[model samples]
Target chain A: MEQSFDDDEGVRWMLAWKAGDEAAFDRLVERYSPQVYALLTRFLGPRDNREDLVQEVFLRLLRNRDRYEPSARFSTFLYRIVFNLAVNHTQRVIQRAEGSLHGRHGDEDGEQLAELADDRASAPFESLEQDDVVRAVRSAIASLPENQRMALILAKYEELPYAEIAGVLGSSEKAVKSLIHRARETLRERLAPFLKEELA
Target chain B: MNLECAAFRRELQHSLENHAERSGAPLRDLLWHRHLHGCLDCRELLSAEEALEALLSSLPNPKLPPGLAQRVLARLSRPAGAQAELDALLELDRPESARPGLAGRVLAHLAEERALARRNPQPVRDLDVLLELARPVEIPVGLAERVKNRTRASTGTRGVLLRWRWMAAAALLALLLGVYAYYPRNPQPSPMVAMQDQPDPALLENLLLLEEWELLQGGDLEVLLSTLPAEDEYLLDLGAEGATEQGGQPKKG
Candidate 1:
């Protein structure tokens, strides 16, 4: 079950946690870990560092728990921490001295069709086509710039309102909207064949 | 595409996200309908966005690692009780009502005290009775004069003595008022008291608490400084005069 707390209830739990209610802390951890894990996986891709980064995110959450103000939704605060940690981790991985070993993954557009075919091994032709469409969409999303990718992820997957997404991004709502719009335009361009076929 | 169609396409996603029912005024809705009928690109864009949204919404939730929370809790080296105590103090370190339900409780306590005083014949004056007696109200024309006469008859004191006593009480009160109004109070407010604002009391409180807690202590500062974006790192370097050259660029020694 996808459990989520509204901002007020979340703040109450946060207050209780701050007041040393271990159960409240457990509730928060249980409630958000899956979502944070999913976000880290999607943003960082499947990497060895992803789990470590997720742990760092929670650790920072605990370390910086005092810095949280109930002014905005707790989710926004949590996501901002996630975004900063993910960005930092990405930068560090990029600059790692042994970076040559951890070469870039997910850059092969040529192999995308093959991957989709493999994913749909036993499926019918229609399912294969649908799977291809899904892969095409995911591929387009995975290829967006970091800021645009995150904005799209928060907007599309988390369904965060633009205002809250703006909070998470530390950008204005207009900027976030533009980011998503440009992201969608890029996705449309990348997936144009699948989109045209699907629409037809 | 015409400018109108372009404008419609640009706003189509926003509108669809907000107004799924296509709710608008008649003329506006007509324009939207006309635009959709005429502009194939807009229709396709809308369809594609919706299809992608559907696909994204259907993506399966990832399975979390088993025993994740226990793993996290185990990473916390500090004892839970100590952390809990500190957290409790932090929680209590907030602004609260000045006199939350205090008046009633004080009154009840005072009543109990008065009952005890009555049983023991103690000299403790009940403030409630004093307040009732001192409360302002209309009185007979010569009420003060009657009081003075009664006091003089009972204690055989002159009006001059009563006047001097009244003058002394007034002077004492004025002196006390002057002292209270002019004396230098504590110049510094507590950190928590220093950071009170309307909406987010916790924001400033947490900022000060973080500073006081020494979040950047030990090598954590280095880790944090390393995480600063390039621009911030540059500014930090420039401000600290740690940069060997001007404009945050390095100079070879």
Candidate 2:
């Protein structure tokens, strides 16, 4: 599906799924799976476990189908669960690096976000072998303190507004902007070689 | 880079990041503030940013691993098959992954505070009563007369209600915090943007730093809102201070 169902439609589907309309649950999966898969890949790198994590997100959705509240946007609830799952999986390796020392106050709320390519054996990102610009950008993104990276993905790729991004990350909009700003600055620094070369 | 260049770079970045600065602000505004006319490096950086942004956004989403949705649906369909496993998998939620509504609790706290405050509101003692407490006469009669007259002039015109300006401000501040707490949760853009117009939050924020909220009374919210600094100024202020106050760190309630 080129453009999946909108958030309202997703809510309707959730309501239907809650009403025991099994097809509604399928529609919900069809609408959100690519997005969930893409977001998980962005956050955790291209690991096989992401497939399982994506499944778990849906399973949680099935379990919490009754927990869906119409007052909030369907996407907000879904993304909160998604990001939370991503954060849980990330803290093990990401927090081990330099970000642990330069910890932001928001770290405790979200997953301890900061990942490493230079660290221990399980360098999941090593699987992503794109070309130069792709490689450099991904590296810079991966190197970002996890919170900044998550904020950047939601803002830059997901195109979620700052406010929604903040909610999903369990942060304030101002902090979301700060996260993106810092993320951008770091990316510029890390990808300086490409940017400077492109400028020349 | 030298400190001056660093400062220039910072200013330039702010100008670029800020939509108002990029679209409407003239170079003369920055040039007047700093000697930016001679710098070639930042000039190139400023221009090259568009290309950089294109490059940044150009990175595509990875192709989804095949059958990702089919697999999710497969599990959803076969509830009986994965029942025990799904039940066990649900237990993986560690404590940090939980996103309880901190705002709901803080807002409840604020409500309890407001209720308690209302039940035992600030005593509305008269300013004259307060002033009378300090009236032991040890001064020369002339000096005492001068002091008393000035004191009367200051207090007589403002009346006693202004003494409760702190309470009014606190009430308004609580109202403002409630409105602010609504922003993150409000998914719609127009409503949240409209909420910004109700009262000048920045102006009200300064109220918290006061011992007595003398600038505003209960009736003055509309007056203050009407006289607020321009929207561009607010955005510029947020952009400038965001890095330090709002953006710098996570301030947990």
Candidate 3:
């Protein structure tokens, strides 16, 4: 099937599916799968189970196909779903780790093990040097407070306009700009040695 | 550089990130102009920051494994049986547009019947006995068979009573409505009636004249009494005694 770039293809496919055409649904899956996969991979990275997460995203898409309204840009709607699920999964993992630690009677040493688990789970990007740098940057990003990290991710990776970023994060454009500025300041500080070499 | 002027360089860093390109001149020109004026450290720092931004932007995005798309597609493809079930369910819920004309005609007929029934009116029968019987009656095996006979027997009486009661109710309502419509009501006064109720000009002038006469009499009496000389008072006393002797009436001068 030939993919369309008309931007309304998602809406067209949805309407056609509602009208009982199966082929249009197939086309929809083909068109949006890669975009959804790309976003999930960015969120989960290489080492964390990408396939399960991607499959989970698509399964949710199937379950929620009826709710897919065409008012927003399809990519925005799709990525919003992916982002929410990924954040939820991350939160669950964090909660599980906390539970384990609490059950073990205040083992401070478990903190290192948890960090190691995180490092190992996020290890696939370590192969390429640039990937390694991006990973480092991502880790630094993940270390940021949730609001700032969300603001940065939507602005940088999603290439969303400040207004759109504001909409996603439930903030104003000025606040979004402030968040990105603060994020960049933090990133610059962390990557100063690397940045200095790059500049040289 | 003075700290006050150096503070602008901090703002310049933020501005450079937010506004990457200078509006008119090349960024280098703007930077060099600022540099020439003062603040060598900031000039160097700005240049370094710009160089780093360029390098970061030039880095290529990493390509994913080739199987990524295939893997995603494979996961999304539902099994044939599941797909068929979903299709069937969707079909069941699909909005039906057939027979609208026939349905509309039937609805119109029912609505017309209802309107006619309302206009002709209906009687209220005493169903209390029937209701009491219904409440206590146990359904026997032969009850259904007796229902048809009972219905036929009651139909004539029901019809006559319903019609008579309807007519009586309508007549009573009409009488009440007529009384409400034609009964005498208190007449509200208009602006013209209020104008007519006001005092007449002749009456108002007479009242004013009476008030002025009383005031004049009071004032004149006070002035005459006040201006009388002491000898005149004694003469008045003598006149009083003389008047008493002469049948108690003073003669007018």
Candidate 4:
């Protein structure tokens, strides 16, 4: 990935927005909306709830404009906010889906099993094989412990350096490396069948 | 290949994570190279890891919905008052004096305190009265008149009177110094001094009353009475006299 470097411009706009310039805020929103949208989409999966969440991320930026610390890169601060909100939205969606079923089914374990089965059965891919591969990968990513999942997203999707991801996640670079290492190992195991199919 | 499988796995994981580290390309450890050549399972793991990375990297970027920036800006087009409040909230790092409506906020806060004080009037009103009393006194009209009259009457003798006043002050100061010089530094109490130092019967009776009320325990009463200094005893005596002067009225009901 080509690592983009418009930080100086982005930071200039943020500082200007902090001083109550509306155009600066507009510029910032325009510049970062795509990244924010992409993060929310991946974090929340293919759900329609992401659009609102992306808007909320920007709204939060405006609402908290004055509190921005220029010493820190704006992207790190923005990702922290986006990650928090994304985690919250993801948890809410999971809870709502589970809550509705828990009332109907009355057996929590069975419902959880059913949910897992449904996740595999309902993957949106072109063919059965592709669906299995894609589903396995997505489910593996989703099932990761929140920190590992976020570490992978920030490193792989955002193309952030380990040090920068560490800053975003409030962890050491070594810790982030271990997180991504463990996460990738898990993904490799889950997708091994598909990899072998490709080899065959 | 003499590489332990576990060590090879660890190195492979490390290399994969650090492959594109800002410094340069990943390290190619000899053990990992030998293990991959010798072990089919390890080779399969590497291939799978590479495929997973490719799949992840190739995932489509989520397109921004049409008009998101416009929608966000539209939401931000709040009324001017709300915009100012938002600006104030965002600029909390700015100095309080630099924030808009600060004077208005301070005046509002003071007005709230004034209203609250009015509602709970007794303590605040008492404090206000105490402050008024403590303020410096202006010259009294009668005293002013008296001083002028006396000055006119004693004009010829004024210098002599002033000299006499200084002499009186000097004599009082000398007496005070003589008494201070004669005073014992750490006087041991004589029988007469002990008798004078003893608390009044009325005070002893009050301590006994407090004990009956269970307000003062026996040990506490002894500690309290034993630890009181002569100055505290004098003040207690004066306080008792003042209370008696008021016919021993209850200070609180």
Candidate 5:
């Protein structure tokens, strides 16, 4: 179950922002933008327009500010906004990326797929021995099935519990656990070489 | 494979549920220390888990553009800046009717409307309601007729269907209650608000919740979740950059 946020810092600040304290909203922007930036970077890949996307997230918050009553956690509401934005944005971007590629390489469909793969490419895994465990792990995570990848990232990095991850991902807790389990399994297999030896 | 291994895995389950494990918790659990002695794969799993945690902590953060918060706040304050940016964002077929000038444009229009309203105040002729005089009130899109027909036609399966409709209404009401519990300030909004009630975005979100809850009443949600595309293979082409630093990575939400 999700925790209550009736008195959460973000909620209080947002309520104050609703009460005409523009500085309160600024406090929220300062405090939460890093996390938002990180998630957008993760979800959208490293693109030039990322800061714009981050701005869009807050812009969405600003636009929908009145809709936000103090009922739910401000972070949860913000996350829902970002997650939906990212999904829709990713869908649009990838479609555009593919369309541009298809247009450019009208003849060579095979090469188009390969170049698209590298739109947000991982470093070559050919030299895993030289690559640090972190690089190996990032590539492995980048390669995961979408559901598993999101569940793991939210669970492991963002410090959200399985239930909240489920809430964010529109899945039940069991499904979230299944997703994480599948993610861990894949990570274990992919990073097996790096994971084999115990840490010093 | 053995009982101790199963037990070791049981103790390990809480690792994901808690954050302390990610911050690099020491191997203090005697059960963890004890079980690893007998199992090879379990020991490997333990090593992998620890290594993953370490790598995660050491992962680089994406470099932020100079003054990101400032940029966003500037846009918030400056309607002109926001208008140009929002026009670009409008390219994405976002569900909201965020047309080109959504932010600055809306504000400008509202300001204009305010000015207009002040300039032209319509004379108010208060209707005599206490006279109980019937005015030609337009029926609200046949809702009263539909309710009248439904009440008149409630019989057998029709009554059951009506009951199901009420149940769905109650379910929707409960979902609303869950998202927006007692509105403390204005528990009941004005009739104007009630007239303009639109579907809650949160209500749409919790539909998934209510669906899962209903399905799981006698079945597993995992089974249902299994059907949700684990990966849109076409979309996974976008790749995830959540973990990577600037410049290169796959993008997927």
Candidate 6:
């Protein structure tokens, strides 16, 4: 069974925090930080910057906590923040690469492998074969168009409802469904060989 | 598979994700079962889709790094005192006599009570009576103390004088009520006199003049003034301005 945190608990923490109870605010962060971190890692991929991005996401939450209402689910609200931050970070990296004549011939590969190990520890695989499959899936996911990738990540990984995915993507639910359908078809085509082997 | 059979298989796969249960939908279930039995190609496709869904669902939940909670708590703790200061500022911003919406109104009432309690710090007899009189309303959390502090600051020395004035007003109200209880009931005044007793003549005249005027001023005036009977066309005598009638009737003096 999934260990679900009561939404009311976060609301209560907010109420208590508003009432000048500091401990309640701490408890609120403790309750949600892991989920937020997991979501960020899923979106941004296993990288050294994941922890820093996670911190930034929480810092953003702290800065804007007063604005949080119980309208959307807390996870939805949190995921939206993580999604935007990850997208912005990706855009920045792209921009940096475009500006520089010499690509930052940094040790990104080594760092990425270490981060991958850490990420895999949290997202346990049945075997090394499964890990390779996951890595291949991640690469295929990255190759998708940005909107399609975001839709796929939110739907397949985050398990957000179609409506919430629409909200995050600023598209209609019908459009979001089409994007996911297209994305899934692309993944199926791309991973056909691996999947066929697995089935065999 | 035939194009028709492939399309049917695709629809079944889509419905499996979108719909809650496929059990009782006769045509759909029959199509699905038939496709699975007769078509190896469709069967493999369906199995692949299910496996993909299961794999997606099986992604593990990650945990936050050590001490992350402590860091968040530390940041949140610093904000408390700052929030109190901001609360005071916000209280100063709000109107004094105006009732805030549900949350704001409740907080204001609580703030007033908290102030009173702070001033005495001693147990007062019939504190519950005072509380009932005050009518503590539910406020948005964290607003009351802010409102109270600001109210206290702004009122200054006049706070005590305002309390005395309130007591005096209460006493006068009680006196009026006692006199009203013992006094004999007078007969209801005539409608004209009651209308006259209303302070504004412009309001009364506006009430009487219906139709074009009422249409411009909107609302259910017909319902409001339904008791007044409609009069037949009154003379629009131009005699006051010394004009003669074309019909040759003598002008009334």
Best by DockQ: 5
Model 6 regions more than 4 Å off: A1-24, A101-131, B1-31, B54-64, B75-253
Clash pairs of candidate 5? A42-B241, A42-B242, A120-B249, A120-B250, B238-B251, B239-B250, B239-B251
- How many backbone clashes does every candidate have? 0, 3, 0, 1, 7, 3
State the displacement of the C-alpha of residue A105, model 3, in Å, after optimal TM-score superposition: 14
Decreasing lDDT order of the candidates: 4, 5, 2, 1, 6, 3
Model 4: residue A132 alpha-carbon error in angstroms: 4.8
Over A1-200, each residue of candidate 6 has an lDDT whose tens digit, in order, gives 54343555766676575555656656767888767766776666655456555555655555454445555556666677777777766664554444442544345434444443433233222333565766666566666776787888777666677887887777898899899889888767766655665566
Q: What DockQ, on C-alphas, does every prediction get? A: 0.07, 0.20, 0.13, 0.19, 0.22, 0.13
lDDT, candidate 1, B2-97, per-residue tens:
898778765765664443243654223555787777778876666787655555655555557787666554543345575556546644653575
- Give per-residue CA lDDT, model 1, range A77-196, as digits (tens): 889989887776555444432333366344332243343333223222344467665545555666677788899888767778888889999999999989988987776666666656
In terms of lDDT, the poorest run of 10 residues in model 4 chain B is B103-112
- Which candidate do you rate higher for lDDT, 2 or 3? 2
Model 6 CAPRI quality: incorrect
**TM-scores, in order shown?**
0.48, 0.46, 0.48, 0.52, 0.56, 0.49
Ranking by DockQ: 5, 2, 4, 3, 6, 1
Each model's C-alpha lDDT? 0.60, 0.61, 0.56, 0.64, 0.62, 0.58
Error of 4 at B26 (Å): 11
lDDT value, residue B242 of candidate 2: 32
RMSD, model 5, all Cα superposed?
40.5
Candidate number with greatest lDDT: 4
Interface RMSD for all numbered candidates: 11.0, 8.8, 11.5, 5.9, 4.3, 7.2
Model 1: per-residue Cα lDDT at residue B116: 32
Better of 1 and 6 by DockQ: 6
Q: Which candidate would rank higher by TM-score, 2 or 3? A: 3
